[model samples]
Target: MNVFDIFWLFFMITALQPILRQRFLEAARQRMIAKIEKSRGSRVILLVHRQETMSLLGFPIVRYIDVNDSEQVIRAIHLTDKDVPIDLILHTPGGLVLAALQIARAVKRHPAKVTAFIPHYAMSGGTLIALAADEIVMDEHAVLGPVDPQLGQFPAASLVRVVREKPLDKVDDQTLIMADMAEKALRQMKANLSELLAGKYEPQRVEELAETLSQGRWTHDYPITFDEAQRLGLPVSKDMPTEIYQLMSLFPQPVRQQPSVEFLPTPRKGHEGGQGTGLFF
Candidate 1:
């Protein structure tokens, strides 16, 4: 081959290398996920949320894209038999509101009773997903954070920006506009939290708790421990031992079987909280 043609061929190979590697890795991961789902005998699904990695890096990240893909997994499980019960294992730091809601809905819709096992942490959206389960099992150290929704940044920070930029005391038309926007943002966040909590708690109690927990920035909000989660009426149990991690390690990582696109959801616009905006599966 000519020198230029050889160089072009080399460039093409280099460009495709990462794509090929990613495809292979994804296929293997999906096969593992599917096998784990199937082997539980109870039509169980395993979802891990690693979004805290992005939170630490000061970037938004979608953590539960795989879990949201539960639609197809759920369908596949149902195809095997409609009567199989579902056991969902979750370990997440949480992600987008809508995405969590989607997974929660799928768990709720399954004909089997949904049981959630939390080995470590289920924060934010993760906690939301756990709420959908009939029973939530956690170890002594496991945690579930409050469902207080913040609009990307913390609500207090948004309020501070408005007040500092345009003193609320001597508000101009622009200041008034900024103040109104901030107020609306905070109000909407409060309302969303209230609504989400209402689904899990009595309306009066949820309203009371929402007022107390929705005050901080996203970074500063504290995570509730298993004890606190139980106090919040989350149907949490602490004595159960979790063997999922050990069991996962024993399973042979499955061979690459299909293209990832066949399994993953289509990518869409990014949301404020690093959550993927589109529904998957």
Candidate 2:
């Protein structure tokens, strides 16, 4: 080939490499999902969020649980037969409350069992969705966070409490209006969450659990580990499927100029007391 032709061919290959790599990864994810569904006899859906780079610009964009995600999940549930169970793999930091509620309600309404799998964490609105599942499977270290409603950057419960503690004349009109909205939002969240837990727990326990979750008792980012979740009466287990972890590895974080963390990808075995414990690190 001529020198110019060879140079152009190399440029084209370099340009298409990223696109081809992304396409291959997507195909691999689909195949893995199909394998899981076939082995478990359930419809599999994944709501995974990650900070990924744009194909050309390389600018990072963080994903969340949004309306589009809810729409797609609801549609998947609708397509499944009533008798078919669902396996929802969630790995997110949460998002819009309205979108989360839509997905949660849809999951609650499904005839067959709905299981939520968390290999890392599902916080805030993600936790709201997990509440609707018949069972929650998490890795031993994975966590779920609180679902207390936030008004702008502040928690709704805090806003209401602040207004109540302040003198009536000292509070501004705008603050009063915010407090009113906050109270309503808190009430609505409790009611909605209570409805989700209704059939699963006792009447009084339902209200108590709902209030605890919606009352801003803890910071929004506070992690509720498997042990704590169990103590709180949630239907949680540490029996995470290996395929779920494999699926998460496919959704890599955005590439950076310099990686923040690095480790050997393979497991290592350790011997203790002259016995091979098969310890991995």
Candidate 3:
């Protein structure tokens, strides 16, 4: 070939290298997706919430399970018959008390079985939702935390304790009002926890477990291991399916300082044609 023609050929090959690499990456990702899908049984839906990741830009900001999510999942369940099972893949640092309560209630009351799978961490309100599950599967390193409800930025138990321990004259009127609200939140939380444990334990024991969990016996984010959870009256198993790690690999911690996209799909080889053979990232 002529020198100019050879140079042109080399340039074309170099230019297409990135396209080839992207195609390879896309293919690998598709295989992983297929594997995860295959592991799930027929008529099962996986709901995942990874708190360490940022969900939407210019939105409510922090990524945590919320009321809006309850609406979506509940509606999705409504569309299907009661026979389908719901698998919750929970890994969260917890969020609003009421929001978590809404989701826990929906899951608890679902006609079909609801299972919670925790590979790493599910704390505070996350624990509340996990409590509602028919069965909970956890890894040896996995943790389900205290269900102590939070009011505003403070734990309800802490607020209530301060009011009870401190002199009435020393506390401000405004603080007293806040403490009153916190007490109410505590009651609500205890009642909810008791209800969630209804079928799992006796009525008196249900209230006791609820009190222990909601009374700030442990820190809100304290990691209750698999054994600890079982001891505390939660229906938890140490055995977790192998495919969960593959799913968790899909979500990495958020880098708040930088703007980024998790995946970006672009045109590769056959994409240039109307009938595309594959997509690349």
For residues 1-281, write the lDDT of model 2, one tens digit per residue.
99999999999998898899899889989988998999999999999999888887788888998999999999999999999999999999999999999999999999999999989999999999999999999888999999999999989988999899989899999989999999999999999899888898999999989988888899888999999999999999888878888877887787677989986676555564454434231
> Can you write out model 1's per-residue Cα lDDT over 1-281, one digit (the tens) per residue?
99999999998998776567657756766665566566665656666644332212335444454444556545644564547767777776666666666676666666666778887777777776777776888878877775555554644445546677865677667655655666765565567556555555788887776665554434434768888866766678874532465433332222235643344444554575575656432
Cα shift from native, residue 193, model 3 (Å)? 1.1
* lDDT, residue 204, model 3: 87
Better of 1 and 2 by lDDT: 2
List all candidate RMSDs to the true structure.
Answer: 13.0, 2.7, 10.9
Superposed Cα RMSD, model 1:
13.0
Per-residue lDDT value at 97 in model 3: 80
- Superposition error at 96 for model 1 (Å): 1.5
- Name the runs in model 1 displaced over 4 angstroms: 1-41, 50-83, 156-166, 169-201, 209-221, 239-242, 248-281
Estimate every model's Cα lDDT from 0 to 1: 0.62, 0.91, 0.75
Candidate 3: 10-residue stretch with minimal lDDT: 51-60
Total clashes, candidate 2?
Answer: 0
Which one wins on TM-score? 2
Order the candidate numbers by lDDT, best to worst. Answer: 2, 3, 1
lDDT of 3 by residue, 45-152 (tens): 344564342223323345777777677766765765677677777787777687788888888888878888888888887888889989999998888888887777
